[model samples]
Target: MTRRPYRDLVIFARGGGWGVDRAADGYDPVAVIRGTDFAAVRSGRTETVPRRWEKRTLIVPRRVRPGDVLLEISGGSVARGQTTGRSLFVGPDVLPAFELPVIPASFCRLVRFDTTLVDPRYAYYGLLDMYLSGRAGDYENQSTGISNFQFERFLDAELLRVPPMAEQRRIAGVLAALDDKIEINERVVTATEELLRAEFDALAVTGHGSVPVTELVEFNPRTPPPERAGAPYVDMAALPTHVAGIRSWSHRPPRGGSRFRNGDTLLARITPCLENGKTGYVDFLAPGQTATGSTEFIVLRARPGVPPQFPYFLARDERFRGHAVRKMAGSSGRQRVNAADAADFRISVPSPERLAVFGERAGAAFTHMAGLLAESRALQSLRDALLPELMAGRRIRPAPAPAVTGAATDDAGSSVYAQ
Candidate 1:
């Protein structure tokens, strides 16, 4: 509430430290979220994310309130609205790993701008731009990461050019509009998926007969051949999202891993990540390339008559995950599920007729969801592009977008500013 041209922002570490886990594909929030509590996050998105703990150097906000901006001074680059991904906190008396220092609340500084000086949303966009451009220029990195990465503290100290609040609002308006649309699209996809899955379960009848999923389908060996020297390792990072696909591949070449083939289903056999439904179906594995993944995922192939989508659907089911959780063993702190259990797990395979019917319905839902997912991703990209430009003085004329004018701001051209 200060009219001061410059305000102070404080960042600190609090709560406890977070634990990292191996997600199916990319890593999930092991350190940031509810410390491996996938069950809680799955049940409650916002609450689970916000209340989750991680004892990092918590960036405590100076005077943060609802609707105020929260910038992760440390996380290098972020999409416009998506920057506010998850809560940054730890439980009582906990601390981050001593090796990985977190952003202490003291490290943050608030930019106190008069409402007339700079709209906070607009400032956020500027911050995003600075973050990205800095990365591109390599200004944020200190020599190949062998050196310290101190962009967060540096940015906090760097000065920002504050424009009139009205202008900030206008610039923010356009960017926000795209973000709002993207958010809406994401919700639609999630709602539709949830509804379809719920309906499928309701229609599905429980038959007691059981068979190992491995037997019901064909299995492939994707393990990279024994590493001679510079060969790639089959780490989990190679797996893709949603359906079975490999987006990226690499050969670390240390361990003697096997290889995977096309149409093979990658079932994650690790805790936390396995619980998070980290499964991917390989559409194709380059000949002799031998795709690799973490010993975490159990790779398999569905036999003829089984839809490619069928494996994906079953792998994502909660029941399958529960079986995965039960099969896990090892240290309590970091449970490791074995590949053997995944290769020979019992599943409630419906009759062929039921499998066909359910597959048909699930297929429709997957198609619809896929479209929504693509669209949402596009909208998000656009929104991200405009965020920094509008926020920083990189683009746009000054002027707070006229507060959504039509009795209901969203419908009006200026709706982007709707509180």
Candidate 2:
């Protein structure tokens, strides 16, 4: 088959290298792979780091200009066309990622379709969804894992046989609208959460009313045995931001690295991430469900009036994490937080009436946010389901296979996605 020459389109690397941040996974300011900004940047690490990149930055070539295509050839899993989508600006810091010889830009037809078919930002987020979709599995392990999409395969599987340019544009447009809404809704949720957290932080209930966590809660640690399989397991990756429940699992729950009952709080006791807000309250679990996590968490179990949702807020609270850090900074073996330090950390326990009011209101807000987030994810699923087909000219707004039934969803009556 004669291929279209993409020689004229501008191409650049996509993912930032993980090397700089490997030493400190949580807060490496030198590389963006683990930085604080959940928002994507085109180049340079967003955090302030003492060490600067030895090589070039991550932006695009001056000749190609800003509107040119930004293709990410090598990334998390090195197949091909791993990053299949649209990008515009080339951030300066992104340059160093392409210093190696084995990696190639020309593998997957990385072209700059610098036209109006897709919004660059929307396409960027879409590409991320593609990458994150396969996070269930480690890098390339498949059986129970989702394999990463390399750029080469991406071209063969995605780039080579896309639908007519017009249809690609249409599909991209529809998907962009849904993502745009999702982004807006997410921003609203963040702002609401910030407002609530700020109010909780400033309340005049810190002094005499303060009590040690050990008084009202229990610190129980479980160690994972040599055995690696049996029951479902909760890897660190399973923990998401603001979760009060565990949804995903990888290995079986270990014999005992840590334990948590429903409504217990799980705080990552390690560095960087402990600072990055990686705590969650256990609100939902199946009947007799027992999941274990990496030895990196301090499970907070309340005695009684310590409203269940309170852990959710305290987990997000800077004060709780601050005490957690000061206590662990001097620790010896494996950087773990001691149960006594947890006991030393203090928080004001308001009257049960006040806590009940706070917990009920906060929990309701969390449920609402979770619902919205769940809906956004479902919309994303719909978009993904249609992408390959629509881009391949196999599906469209109106159906071609009239009355044929499958997992495909129409404009309305879509399946509600949840665990």
Candidate 3:
């Protein structure tokens, strides 16, 4: 194994060339990926944002290639923290029909690897490990409130230990196997959600009746924190843009966040986050448990006869989101949705019998999706635990599949690791 400056492995690392021109939102109509889009990619979820609705852009536009790795460049957190340094590689699975050269916004940078010198997949996972391990954070420039990483400086000062190409491939394959199952499970969850949405659409067509959101659900209900500290706390980031559930949180002093109990839906009401679709259903907490999160959240809980999942799906719907975006009022960066406007928006309500039926179906589907999400978390834990050991030259194959799959052999007569 040999060590090399991080820069020697890349052909070019540059910031995005073009930005969203606010003046051209409708006129430009160009497809673009921004720092916000990274949230969807990171969560293994896909969301469609109309080109005309994206915020103002920079004049320069940098086209993305399939193999290029996109990294967030501007944010409060730097290279080491979960708040920043999120990376996603552009590939066929992510953009199968990517015909036109989609531009990257200024807040993102594209890093192209020299595949002849390194395996791209291996490099991606390696970078991920570095970030997770906090090794990458050592190179960050922390002169201001936001942590920033300069690629040129990182390449010059940082050293990457390169394993033999064969080992790199093997390491990547093992890790990717875990990721493949996670992705597969995510796809299943997405499909289930789409079905539920279809049912909602159908119910809307029948026109049982309609009521304002406030009439059907509680808005920002108050849940005063316990006299003590260390309650579960969730920031905006914990609520993913398109993911079905929250996978992370912290225990902190009860302070300054919208409070809610289990089964509540937390929908981001601020500019970029709202526009990006950051919403999460609260199921991770124990029964009767209460938690608080960024005040930017609008807490919605179903009223009597309404399914617990109703508010979650309603917040996730495109129409509701579009309406919220339209009602946002404020300065360029500080815009927020007017709570009154949101509460006043009319939502179609089904008849009691039909509502109960839809509730059962949607509840069943969500329960299954939550189970899959839990399994994916376990697989991710295994992959993360194995990554460092594999990168350090420890030769160990993954343990044979547990009886989870109900069979010892896969379709090819090999032992299955997972379904």
Weakest 10 consecutive residues, lDDT, candidate 2?
100-109
Instruction: Give stretches of model 3 more than 4 Å off.
Output: 12-14, 19-31, 42-63, 76-84, 97-99, 142-146, 205-210, 222-229, 318-332, 335-341, 395-419
Q: Model 1, 182-224: lDDT tens per residue?
A: 4454555556655655654653322342667765655444344
Q: Note the Cα lDDT for every prediction shown.
A: 0.47, 0.47, 0.70
Model 2 CA deviation exceeding 4 Å by range:
1-113, 116-164, 204-210, 221-232, 241-247, 250-255, 329-334, 396-419
Residue-pair clashes per candidate: 54, 27, 12
TM-score of 3: 0.80
What order do candidates take by lDDT, descending?
3, 2, 1
Please give the range of 10 consecutive residues that has the lowest summed lDDT in model 3.
Answer: 406-415
Q: Candidate 1 versus the native: TM-score? A: 0.59
Candidate RMSDs in Å, in order, are 10.7, 9.5, 5.2
lDDT measured at residue 242 in model 3 versus the true structure, 0 to 100: 62
